[model samples]
Target: MALNYDEIVGKFDKYIFNTYTRQPIAIKKACGAVVTDVNGKEYIDCVAGIAVNNVGHCHPAVVEAIKRQSEQLIHVYNLYYTEQQALLAEGLVNLTEMDRIFFCNSGAEAVEGALKLARKATGKKVFIATEHAFHGRTRGALSVTHKEKYRKPFEPLAPAVFVPYNDAGAIREAITNDTAGVILEPVQGEAGVIIPDDGYLGEIREICDETGTLMILDEVQTGFGRTGKWFAREHSGIKPDIMTLAKAMGGGFPMGAKLAREDVAANFGRGDHASTFGGNALSCAVALSNIEVIKKEKLVAKASDLGAYLMEELKALDKDYVKEVRGKGLMVGMELSIKCEDIVAKARECGVLLNCTSDSVLRFVPPLMISKEQLDTVVGVINEI
Candidate 1:
């Protein structure tokens, strides 16, 4: 029996929460850089599950790891020791300079954990975040997020101060006695793939060191080879005190983690924090394979190479609507003079999938495995639009 697209959509309308104004496509299968709709129409995927499919959709290694782990153990909770969880932590710590890691289930949970750890470590109440920044939708993460529209409805959130991004002087001025930490995205994603100045991250690190303030980097969108490097902070040569990671970490499986230095992470007591489903065997196994695939397939360097090519091709195009093209690695964004929603719809009609953020910036975070030929098709479609 074939799947009923309209009936499935109707069921979603009646049963699911109306949180997302989703595109009218029922994706039923995906592999590498393409997705097939319920009706069997295939489209070249550029969103990569909003930057969560760094290893590409349904990577063989990741799928095998998940399947093998599921046959052995799926969930044992955090109370008991699990080999997969321990190995994942070791892998994360080895990849990053951080000494300890706390696993969770999503990017939002990681951000929330990082916030709590910062407050506990510094014994402070306030946090400074950048304007146009997006951490997560959870209350603690939402508190530091800078958008008025997302934070307005959930007013009276945790006390946080907001400042302009890419401005080191503002961050220095914002830090005070009550400031626990400063959190920022190495390259702002939701606000249109905004990359900061060369020395911005290093400057923030110096200021945090001078003021005894914890520095947190939200790498939810930029981690796991998305920004060419394993993490975007490597581009700036600065290691933050706390780093939040998710999105691509699980290789399409849901997972998140908050990493911190030894002394900083030690602030959390035995009863300080816990998650019922966090660090489960299934997610850990998949994440381990995800990292392994990235290393084995050399996807990081591939992303760097292909991202440059894509950006160059887009910039070289003589288009009136293109205002700017900027980003690092596979996380590129094309700013347009006109609204991009219609362009995205048109691209979908042309057998290409695209996403627009901040109304006018067309975000292109395709699978690292996307070929230059496939990218040419995407660029050709955009040029036509």
Candidate 2:
């Protein structure tokens, strides 16, 4: 009376949509940075659910919070307020000077809300995003995503202009009077952890200031201490007009938020925009627990230290297959000399779970709580590959 991999895959193929070419591994149980398949083979989860498990899987504090909240008040809609949501909002405001917050269900919804805020506040319809960007799949967020594969089917997408990423001149040139907002990931996560030039964010801030455009930072994959600092742009000492956050915010629970300056946030009044399950009590409890654990455990500082160690270890593996390793905090990327898919597959055999970004770059976004020994294991796997 047990489940097998074949049975699981057959059920999924019948019921699930044919979108992602998923691996054949069926994860049965997970804890910390490791997941065990149904056959009891363990693999280090270097992907960390694509950076959504910043604190690690089934963190005790997060689990306790979810249990307590479900027993107390599980699904209080955003229409009615709750203490957990208020506390989370206050913590966020204290964390950043941003004024208002809109809680949503995922990264895509957060991007959607941010764009709506920009358009509503500026009274403009056009958005400027960077090429090779991957925001989300929703209609509003998808419109601004610059990848053709993600946008071609949904053509005539919301009058969005695609600019080259990391080019300040091109971004400045693209800023017309009609531009409603400019959105870009501080370090492009899906675009291969692409770090812009040192002064690029400040340049963007200046441009947004001069052109009267709302600056939006898509921190979906980079926020919640992945980038050493709380947010990657903080490294540049630049403030965005609106910043969208998700991924690690909920510690695996589906949650996202758009943070904006108070006056700018005020543009949307009663029912200007709404979501049915947007700030539900359960998500708030989970998100709060995630943040609490991050702070209590000082995982941010750990990310800074271990990330440095990981980088140093990776660079030691500089071989013909290895191209370059660059990262800030736990968010690292390895630009391979060749396509990295097989290398990743080989690493999976070596008891590690890493992912490839684009076709050539290998992305390393492990949990912020990854131990030095675990990182050493990662290095050994790379050496095997």
Candidate 3:
């Protein structure tokens, strides 16, 4: 039995919670920078599952890893250690240069874990976050997230101070005796791909060290070759005290992790934090394979080269409405004087998928494997629009 678009939409309306502002077309399947709708029309996928499919959708390695792992073992509670989990932990620590790791299911769970670890390590209750930052939507993560609309309804959240981004002085002033940690995204993804000044992150690191506060870098959207490097922090050459990883971590499989220095990680005892489904055989296998594929394919270098190409092409486009074009690697954004909702719909109609963030910024986070020809077509379509 095949369901049409209306049928799927009707079912969602009747059965699903009304939260997401969904696009009209229902994607049937996706592969390597392209998605086919139920009606069989294909669109160049620029969104990349909101930057989740870094290795491209259903990459052979990831699919095979999932199949092989399922045959051996699908899932077991974290009570029993699994070889896959241990291997994945080692791989993550080596890649991230963090001393310890904690597994979880999604970006929000990772942020929640990082926040808890920060508080526990420093014995502090207050956190300082940057303005226009988006960590996650969970209660603890939401408290540090900077969007008022998301934070207003749930008042009396955990104590946190919001400071202007790219300003180390504001962070210094915000730190109090009860401050636990400071959390920030290396590149502000949801806020129009906002890239801070060259020395901003280093300044924050210095201030955090001076104040004895933990520095938590949220790499949920910017990790795993999305930003042309294994991790965005490499751009600054600073090691965060705590880091959150997800989004592309499992190559579309649900997985997240919180990593910290060894001493900071000691704050969490045996029973302090555990996820029932996290680090199970299947997720760990998928994540391990995802990392292997990223390394073997050399997608990091590909991202750096192609991202430069994409941004240059976009910059060449007529700038009558374009306010700015900026980003690092594959994480580029085009801010327009006009709102981007109508432009997004028009692009979708013209056989491309685009995401509008911060009301006016058109975010482009395509798969690292997207071809130059496909990206050229995407730019052509936007230019024609």
- lDDT for position 78 in model 2: 72
Candidate 2 is scored at a TM of 0.98
The reply for model 2, stretches above 4 Å from the true place, is none
Q: After best superposition, candidate 2 residue 128: deviation in angstroms?
A: 1.1
lDDT by residue (tens digit), candidate 1, 1-385: 8667998899999999999989999999999999999988899999999999988899999989988999999999987999999999999999988999999999999999999999999889999999999999999999999889999999999999999999999999999899999999999999999999999999999999998999999999999999899999999999999999999999999999999999999999898989988999999999999999999999999999999999999999968878999989999999999999999999999999999999999999999989999999999998887
Q: How accurate is candidate 2 locally (lDDT)?
A: 0.90
What lDDT score goes with residue 272 in model 1?
95
Superposed by TM-score, candidate 2 places the C-alpha of residue 377 at a distance from the truth, in angstroms, of: 0.8
Per-residue lDDT, model 1, residue 343, is 93
TM match of model 3 to true structure = 0.99
TM-score of 1: 0.99
Give the lDDT of residue 74 in candidate 3.
89
Provide TM-scores for the models. 0.99, 0.98, 0.99
Residue runs of model 1 more than 4 Å from their true location after superposition: none
Q: On a 0 to 100 scale, what is the lDDT of residue 379 in model 3?
A: 98
Candidate 3 per-residue C-alpha lDDT over 161-249 given as tens digits, one digit per residue, 9 for 90 to 100: 99988898999999999999999999999989999988989999999999899999999999999889999999989999999999999
RMSD of each: 0.7, 1.0, 0.7
CA lDDT of every candidate: 0.95, 0.90, 0.94
Where in model 3 is the C-alpha error above 4 Å? none
Angstrom error at residue 342, model 1: 0.5
